[model samples]
Target: MARVVVDVMLKPEILDPQGQAVQRALPRLGFEGIADVRQGKRFELDLEGPADEAALARIREIAGTFLANTVIEDFVVRVEEPAEAASADNNAEEGAVR
Candidate 1:
């Protein structure tokens, strides 16, 4: 199976109250030096086959039409490597850490 990731973010001109709230709280929680924060949404899709150009185009259309409001938001779609590859990478990292 192929994994497709869609990230939806508000336009630069749009105000993000939730993101602002998080930014404000970060200082109080002992985290600092963050200039700003913009919250966004993520959608992961598991497809039956590889993520080819056609699949990516279809996902882009879906993201623009259904996942994001084109007037106030923008979206990016990408394909992630298979879970087995990711797992192997994670295991390698763990081994290195130990």
Candidate 2:
């Protein structure tokens, strides 16, 4: 099955309190050298078929209408390679080295 990934993130002008909180906590938790953090949401949709142009268009509409607040957030929708294909590519790279 194909997969559609929707990434929703606040606009650069908007303040992200949740992200700030995490950033602050990270320092307290002994993590350092991080100057900034912006949190976002990711939605994974497993499709029964390929994510063609029409399907991508529909997903964009859905993302703009319901998933992201266009006024304050921006969203991106993309197709993801199947897990098997990705692993196969990785395996090929590994084999090529040896």
Candidate 3:
């Protein structure tokens, strides 16, 4: 199984009304060291199968075609490996040292 972590953010030039409102409120609330706070979105997807070429391709297509707006927003996908893959990496390190 794979856990796909996606981050979607607005382009820098795009104005974020909600984030600006929050930024304005922070100073009144005495929260210091707060600069411009532009909010974005995070999505965690539980993928049923393995993370292979086809799966990665599908993820990119989905993000570009629907999830992320090509004009104003951009997205990045991070694929988390399965438990077995993690163990295999650990085992490889153990053997490499011996």
Can you give the TM-score per candidate against the true fold? 0.83, 0.83, 0.76
lDDT of 1: 0.89
What number of clashing residue pairs does each candidate have, in the order they appear? 0, 0, 0
Worst 10 residues of 1 by lDDT: 89-98
**Which tens-of-lDDT digit does each residue in 41-81 have in candidate 1?**
99998888789999999999999999999999999998876
- All-Cα superposition RMSD per candidate: 4.6, 5.7, 8.6
Candidate 2: the clashing residue pairs are none
Q: Write the per-residue lDDT of candidate 3 for residues 21-59, one digit (tens) a residue.
A: 999999899998888998888887778988778888898
* lDDT of each candidate versus the true structure: 0.89, 0.89, 0.81
Q: lDDT tens digits, residues 1-98, model 2? A: 78899999999999999999999999899999999999999998887878999999999999999999999999999998765435656455544422
| Cα lDDT, model 2, residue 94 | 41
Q: Candidate 2, which segments miss by more than 4 Å at Cα?
A: 83-98
TM-score (C-alpha) between model 3 and the true structure: 0.76
Off by over 4 Å in 1: 83-98
Over the full model, what C-alpha lDDT does candidate 3 score relative to the true structure? 0.81
